[model samples]
Target: MDNFLEIETSVKRVFNSFRHEVDGILDRKLTGGEFRVLSLISSGVNRTTDLSKKLDVSASHITAITDSLVANNFITRHRSEVDRRIVVLELTEEAKEFVASIEQKKKEMIVRRFSVFTEEEREQFQELLKKLAEN
Candidate 1:
Protein backbone atom coordinates (compact mmCIF):
# COMPACT_ATOMS: atom_id res chain seq x y z
CA MET A 1 0.00 0.00 0.00
CA ASP A 2 2.80 2.40 0.87
CA ASN A 3 4.63 1.66 -2.36
CA PHE A 4 1.51 2.16 -4.44
CA LEU A 5 0.72 5.44 -2.74
CA GLU A 6 4.21 6.73 -3.27
CA ILE A 7 4.10 5.80 -6.94
CA GLU A 8 0.73 7.45 -7.39
CA THR A 9 1.83 10.62 -5.70
CA SER A 10 4.99 10.84 -7.72
CA VAL A 11 3.10 10.24 -10.94
CA LYS A 12 0.61 12.96 -10.15
CA ARG A 13 3.34 15.40 -9.28
CA VAL A 14 5.17 14.74 -12.54
CA PHE A 15 1.99 14.97 -14.55
CA ASN A 16 1.01 18.26 -12.98
CA SER A 17 4.46 19.68 -13.51
CA PHE A 18 4.39 18.71 -17.17
CA ARG A 19 0.95 20.21 -17.59
CA HIS A 20 2.17 23.49 -16.13
CA GLU A 21 4.99 23.53 -18.63
CA VAL A 22 2.51 22.87 -21.42
CA ASP A 23 0.65 26.08 -20.58
CA GLY A 24 3.85 27.99 -21.20
CA ILE A 25 4.35 26.01 -24.37
CA LEU A 26 0.93 27.15 -25.50
CA ASP A 27 1.78 30.80 -24.76
CA ARG A 28 -1.72 31.48 -23.36
CA LYS A 29 -3.14 31.57 -26.89
CA LEU A 30 -5.23 28.47 -26.10
CA THR A 31 -6.23 26.24 -23.28
CA GLY A 32 -5.17 22.63 -22.85
CA GLY A 33 -8.54 21.33 -24.03
CA GLU A 34 -8.34 23.41 -27.16
CA PHE A 35 -4.81 22.25 -27.99
CA ARG A 36 -5.78 18.63 -27.41
CA VAL A 37 -8.74 18.86 -29.75
CA LEU A 38 -6.60 20.50 -32.39
CA SER A 39 -3.92 17.88 -31.97
CA LEU A 40 -6.52 15.14 -32.37
CA ILE A 41 -7.81 16.72 -35.56
CA SER A 42 -4.27 17.02 -36.80
CA SER A 43 -3.89 13.31 -36.14
CA GLY A 44 -6.94 12.53 -38.31
CA VAL A 45 -9.58 12.28 -35.60
CA ASN A 46 -11.92 14.82 -37.21
CA ARG A 47 -15.36 13.85 -35.97
CA THR A 48 -16.68 15.46 -32.78
CA THR A 49 -17.98 12.10 -31.55
CA ASP A 50 -14.62 10.48 -32.16
CA LEU A 51 -12.77 13.23 -30.37
CA SER A 52 -15.10 13.05 -27.38
CA LYS A 53 -14.51 9.32 -27.14
CA LYS A 54 -10.77 9.62 -27.57
CA LEU A 55 -10.49 12.32 -24.92
CA ASP A 56 -12.96 10.57 -22.61
CA VAL A 57 -14.97 13.76 -22.31
CA SER A 58 -18.65 14.53 -22.78
CA ALA A 59 -19.91 15.62 -26.19
CA SER A 60 -20.92 18.96 -24.74
CA HIS A 61 -17.42 19.47 -23.40
CA ILE A 62 -16.02 18.76 -26.83
CA THR A 63 -18.52 21.18 -28.30
CA ALA A 64 -17.32 23.91 -25.97
CA ILE A 65 -13.74 23.36 -27.03
CA THR A 66 -14.68 23.25 -30.69
CA ASP A 67 -16.71 26.41 -30.31
CA SER A 68 -13.74 28.24 -28.91
CA LEU A 69 -11.53 26.87 -31.66
CA VAL A 70 -13.97 28.15 -34.24
CA ALA A 71 -14.17 31.55 -32.62
CA ASN A 72 -10.38 31.83 -32.56
CA ASN A 73 -10.18 31.00 -36.28
CA PHE A 74 -8.01 28.00 -35.55
CA ILE A 75 -10.46 25.52 -36.99
CA THR A 76 -13.38 25.31 -39.35
CA ARG A 77 -16.22 22.82 -39.06
CA HIS A 78 -18.13 21.38 -41.97
CA ARG A 79 -20.31 18.40 -42.76
CA SER A 80 -18.88 15.48 -44.63
CA GLU A 81 -20.40 15.24 -48.08
CA VAL A 82 -20.97 11.53 -47.71
CA ASP A 83 -22.35 11.90 -44.21
CA ARG A 84 -24.11 15.17 -43.67
CA ARG A 85 -25.04 14.19 -40.16
CA ILE A 86 -21.40 14.07 -39.17
CA VAL A 87 -19.30 17.18 -38.72
CA VAL A 88 -15.62 17.34 -39.62
CA LEU A 89 -13.04 19.65 -38.07
CA GLU A 90 -10.13 21.08 -39.99
CA LEU A 91 -7.15 23.21 -38.96
CA THR A 92 -6.68 26.47 -40.74
CA GLU A 93 -3.30 27.10 -42.36
CA GLU A 94 -2.48 29.40 -39.47
CA ALA A 95 -3.35 26.69 -36.97
CA LYS A 96 -1.42 24.06 -38.89
CA GLU A 97 1.70 26.19 -38.62
CA PHE A 98 1.01 26.99 -34.97
CA VAL A 99 0.55 23.33 -34.07
CA ALA A 100 3.71 22.40 -35.90
CA SER A 101 5.72 25.05 -34.09
CA ILE A 102 4.28 24.14 -30.69
CA GLU A 103 4.99 20.47 -31.29
CA GLN A 104 8.61 21.26 -32.11
CA LYS A 105 8.97 23.36 -28.98
CA LYS A 106 7.46 20.60 -26.83
CA LYS A 107 9.82 18.02 -28.32
CA GLU A 108 12.77 20.22 -27.54
CA MET A 109 11.63 20.75 -23.97
CA ILE A 110 11.19 17.03 -23.37
CA VAL A 111 14.55 16.27 -24.88
CA ARG A 112 16.23 18.85 -22.69
CA ARG A 113 14.52 17.56 -19.56
CA PHE A 114 15.61 13.99 -20.25
CA SER A 115 19.10 14.89 -21.38
CA VAL A 116 20.44 14.59 -17.87
CA PHE A 117 19.75 10.85 -17.84
CA THR A 118 22.08 8.34 -19.44
CA GLU A 119 21.02 6.71 -22.71
CA GLU A 120 20.22 3.39 -21.01
CA GLU A 121 18.21 5.13 -18.33
CA ARG A 122 16.18 7.05 -20.90
CA GLU A 123 15.47 3.86 -22.86
CA GLN A 124 14.35 2.10 -19.70
CA PHE A 125 12.13 5.03 -18.79
CA GLN A 126 10.53 4.91 -22.22
CA GLU A 127 9.92 1.17 -21.93
CA LEU A 128 8.26 1.67 -18.57
CA LEU A 129 6.03 4.43 -19.92
CA LYS A 130 5.10 2.28 -22.94
CA LYS A 131 4.20 -0.64 -20.69
CA LEU A 132 1.97 1.55 -18.57
CA ALA A 133 0.33 3.01 -21.69
CA GLU A 134 -0.33 -0.41 -23.17
CA ASN A 135 -2.12 -1.64 -20.09
Candidate 2:
Protein backbone atom coordinates (compact mmCIF):
# COMPACT_ATOMS: atom_id res chain seq x y z
CA MET A 1 0.00 0.00 0.00
CA ASP A 2 1.06 3.61 -0.50
CA ASN A 3 2.25 5.40 2.62
CA PHE A 4 -0.75 7.76 2.61
CA LEU A 5 -3.19 4.88 2.24
CA GLU A 6 -1.46 2.98 5.01
CA ILE A 7 -1.73 5.96 7.30
CA GLU A 8 -5.41 6.36 6.43
CA THR A 9 -6.09 2.70 7.13
CA SER A 10 -4.24 2.90 10.45
CA VAL A 11 -6.23 5.96 11.43
CA LYS A 12 -9.47 4.18 10.67
CA ARG A 13 -8.42 1.16 12.69
CA VAL A 14 -7.49 3.31 15.66
CA PHE A 15 -10.81 5.15 15.49
CA ASN A 16 -12.74 1.87 15.37
CA SER A 17 -10.75 0.47 18.27
CA PHE A 18 -11.31 3.60 20.33
CA ARG A 19 -15.03 3.45 19.70
CA HIS A 20 -15.31 -0.21 20.58
CA GLU A 21 -13.15 0.08 23.69
CA VAL A 22 -14.93 3.14 25.04
CA ASP A 23 -18.36 1.72 24.36
CA GLY A 24 -17.49 -1.56 26.03
CA ILE A 25 -15.95 0.09 29.11
CA LEU A 26 -18.65 2.73 29.57
CA ASP A 27 -21.54 0.32 29.02
CA ARG A 28 -23.24 2.97 26.88
CA LYS A 29 -25.43 1.40 24.23
CA LEU A 30 -25.69 4.37 21.88
CA THR A 31 -25.36 3.70 18.17
CA GLY A 32 -23.21 6.14 16.17
CA GLY A 33 -26.35 7.92 14.85
CA GLU A 34 -27.90 8.17 18.29
CA PHE A 35 -24.67 9.53 19.72
CA ARG A 36 -24.54 12.14 16.97
CA VAL A 37 -28.03 13.33 17.82
CA LEU A 38 -27.24 13.37 21.53
CA SER A 39 -24.11 15.39 20.83
CA LEU A 40 -26.17 17.90 18.83
CA ILE A 41 -28.75 18.26 21.60
CA SER A 42 -26.00 18.60 24.21
CA SER A 43 -24.60 21.54 22.29
CA GLY A 44 -27.89 23.47 22.62
CA VAL A 45 -31.60 23.40 22.09
CA ASN A 46 -32.29 23.17 18.35
CA ARG A 47 -35.23 22.84 16.01
CA THR A 48 -35.52 19.60 14.10
CA THR A 49 -34.82 21.33 10.80
CA ASP A 50 -31.65 22.93 12.18
CA LEU A 51 -30.45 19.63 13.62
CA SER A 52 -31.01 17.91 10.29
CA LYS A 53 -28.86 20.55 8.60
CA LYS A 54 -26.13 20.42 11.25
CA LEU A 55 -25.99 16.63 11.12
CA ASP A 56 -26.16 16.47 7.36
CA VAL A 57 -28.88 13.86 7.59
CA SER A 58 -32.29 13.67 5.99
CA ALA A 59 -35.15 15.37 7.84
CA SER A 60 -36.84 12.03 8.31
CA HIS A 61 -33.68 10.52 9.83
CA ILE A 62 -33.35 13.37 12.29
CA THR A 63 -37.01 12.93 13.19
CA ALA A 64 -36.43 9.24 13.85
CA ILE A 65 -33.48 9.93 16.17
CA THR A 66 -35.43 12.65 17.99
CA ASP A 67 -38.41 10.37 18.36
CA SER A 68 -36.27 7.56 19.73
CA LEU A 69 -34.53 9.89 22.16
CA VAL A 70 -37.86 11.31 23.29
CA ALA A 71 -39.25 7.82 23.79
CA ASN A 72 -36.13 6.87 25.76
CA ASN A 73 -36.49 10.02 27.93
CA PHE A 74 -33.10 11.35 26.85
CA ILE A 75 -34.62 14.45 25.30
CA THR A 76 -37.71 16.62 25.65
CA ARG A 77 -39.58 18.83 23.20
CA HIS A 78 -40.73 22.37 23.88
CA ARG A 79 -43.04 24.44 21.77
CA SER A 80 -41.73 27.85 20.80
CA GLU A 81 -43.91 30.47 22.44
CA VAL A 82 -43.85 32.92 19.54
CA ASP A 83 -44.12 30.18 16.94
CA ARG A 84 -46.55 27.66 18.32
CA ARG A 85 -45.92 25.18 15.55
CA ILE A 86 -42.16 25.12 16.05
CA VAL A 87 -40.72 22.67 18.54
CA VAL A 88 -37.21 22.64 20.02
CA LEU A 89 -35.35 19.63 21.33
CA GLU A 90 -33.45 19.76 24.63
CA LEU A 91 -31.48 17.14 26.49
CA THR A 92 -32.93 16.05 29.79
CA GLU A 93 -30.98 16.16 33.07
CA GLU A 94 -30.92 12.39 33.16
CA ALA A 95 -29.31 12.31 29.75
CA LYS A 96 -26.76 14.88 30.85
CA GLU A 97 -25.88 12.72 33.83
CA PHE A 98 -25.54 9.69 31.62
CA VAL A 99 -23.25 11.57 29.26
CA ALA A 100 -21.18 12.81 32.17
CA SER A 101 -20.69 9.35 33.62
CA ILE A 102 -19.62 8.00 30.26
CA GLU A 103 -17.19 10.92 29.86
CA GLN A 104 -15.71 10.32 33.28
CA LYS A 105 -15.08 6.69 32.49
CA LYS A 106 -13.47 7.56 29.17
CA LYS A 107 -11.25 10.15 30.88
CA GLU A 108 -10.13 7.56 33.37
CA MET A 109 -9.36 5.13 30.59
CA ILE A 110 -7.35 7.76 28.71
CA VAL A 111 -5.43 8.69 31.82
CA ARG A 112 -4.54 5.06 32.32
CA ARG A 113 -3.37 4.85 28.73
CA PHE A 114 -1.19 7.93 29.22
CA SER A 115 0.83 6.07 31.80
CA VAL A 116 2.40 4.00 29.04
CA PHE A 117 4.15 7.06 27.59
CA THR A 118 6.95 9.03 29.21
CA GLU A 119 5.93 12.48 30.48
CA GLU A 120 7.97 14.29 27.82
CA GLU A 121 6.70 11.99 25.09
CA ARG A 122 3.13 12.55 26.20
CA GLU A 123 3.53 16.33 26.21
CA GLN A 124 5.17 16.37 22.78
CA PHE A 125 2.53 14.01 21.36
CA GLN A 126 -0.26 16.25 22.64
CA GLU A 127 1.36 19.41 21.32
CA LEU A 128 1.97 17.89 17.90
CA LEU A 129 -1.59 16.56 17.76
CA LYS A 130 -3.00 20.00 18.58
CA LYS A 131 -0.86 21.53 15.86
CA LEU A 132 -1.96 18.93 13.34
CA ALA A 133 -5.60 19.49 14.27
CA GLU A 134 -5.21 23.24 13.77
CA ASN A 135 -4.32 22.65 10.13
Please give, for residues 22-134, the per-residue lDDT of candidate 2 as tens digits.
Answer: 77864656766776677777877478998889878899998898899999998899999999999988888988887777767878988886888999999998999899899
TM-score of structure candidate 1: 0.93
Best model per TM-score: 1
Predicted model with the maximum lDDT: 1
User: How does each model score on TM-score?
Assistant: 0.93, 0.75
Candidate 1 per-residue lDDT over residues 57-101, each given as its tens digit: 999999999999999999999999998999999999999999999
lDDT over C-alpha atoms for residue 8 of model 2: 89
| Residue 130 error, candidate 2, Å | 5.6
Regions more than 4 Å wrong, model 2: 25-28, 114-135
Error of 1 at 56 (Å): 0.9
Cα lDDT, all candidates: 0.95, 0.82
Candidate 1: the clashing residue pairs are none
